[model samples]
Target: MLPRLNLRTSFQLAYRARFGWLATGSLVALLSTALLSAQFSGRQPATVALDTGLSVLRLLLSLVLVLMTQELLSREFDRRYFLNTLSYPHPRHSLLLGRFAAVAILTLGLLLLLAVALALLAWLIGQGYAQATPVALGSQYLVTIAFIGVDLLLLTAVASLLAVVASTPSFVLLGTFGFMLVARSFGAIVELLTRNTAVVTDAENYRSGIGLLGYLLPDLGALDVRMIALYGRMELLPADWPWLLLSCLVYTVGLLAMAVWALQRKHFA
Candidate 1:
């Protein structure tokens, strides 16, 4: 475990790929500034511009996290490099955690760098920007990144689990993408089910089934409370924070356990 932690920590600091993502998201800040000028007539257009840019950055970065995670941990190992790790005395859990940690770090760093770029843009644009305070804005951005990290930890754990269990890289990639779609669309799904009666059959049973799924699936969208992070309090109510943090931790551990079990009997074709 300690070795895995060390491995994860070391890999997390290596930002080569992550920096490229940061550069990409920075482009959103540039385009968003122009968009905001046309869309926002408010006195706080600067705030609107920054938030819009951050939103775009957050979205693209999330997708980047999923793609990069699948490529880094799943695709390579699925292609057989996993044998290198298997040859060692290392525990499977360590490998799982190490993989998750590396991806989470990459995601967090990309978001942070994008946040910095957006803040700098706000500073340089001065009229509407005069109201924009970089320190406060940066803190808000950090909080959003923190929120992304919590779920990124859980999601990567699950994705790695899928990879361990899957027969091929294609299967792992498809499964991860499917899970991401479900996790992200659950809200709209529930809303659609509630509003339209034809989509689901056996109303009572359907509701019960979806309810069960809701309890099982992670509430990833809850982490996108960007406005809450940007302009409101970062502190969660004592009761709330612990439950949320625990859910993520438990989900992460559960997925890791599943991954280890699957890998135990795994054999390449």
Candidate 2:
């Protein structure tokens, strides 16, 4: 049992890869902004524009997390770089946490860059078409961005946790993507199964199954504040903010704990 851990070394290893990933994120942001500028809508161009830009940024951020997780964990371990790092005095948990922190920092930084770019584009578009459009951005938009950051952090932890159990980079990437899809949709699936009795088959059983999944998966739906931001519904934000943050923390910690457990048991030989 290793008692001492070197977080700095692990973080150094993780941070070294940030430049490439950040460039990829920036390119995606640029393309998303360009698409927003080119969109044509007969009604509510502002809403459409905001939605399209956000959707693109969200997808791009997701991709960044997936790729980042693969690069930082799966590939490094596959190539024995991570094992070499572990050869140092660092405990498995410390290495996992340090790498997680590095990835979280990178994701948060990219989120900030993307948010600023989106805001700048929104502002410019509003100014360019103020009279012809209803583009209104406020601090509330920042609130949405903050929640999106939380969502990405949660995803980073999820991907990190999955990578520990996954054998190959491809498996980690695909598994992470699939888990993201399910976690993001878990709430909606539950609602649909419970509310739409006509479409749902064996409603009770389906609900039970989904409920079990919900218990196991993080409720990402709670972090979705885009609609509130889009409609400027600041009043509705308060009720969920505290709970959402708490849930995000709980889920992130849980995932990291699992990753640490997996790493402790993982044999480099």
Which of the numbered candidates is closest to the native, going by highest lDDT? 2
lDDT of 2: 0.74
Over all chains combined, what TM-score does candidate 2 have?
Answer: 0.85
lDDT for 155 (candidate 1): 70
- Could you tell me which residue pairs clash in candidate 2? none
Evaluated with TM-score, which candidate comes out highest?
2
Worst 10 residues of 1 by lDDT: 126-135
Candidate 1 achieves a global lDDT of: 0.63
Per-prediction TM-score:
0.71, 0.85
* Candidate 1 ranges beyond 4 A from true positions: 1-43, 122-141, 187-209, 230-241
> What does each candidate score in C-alpha RMSD?
4.9, 3.4
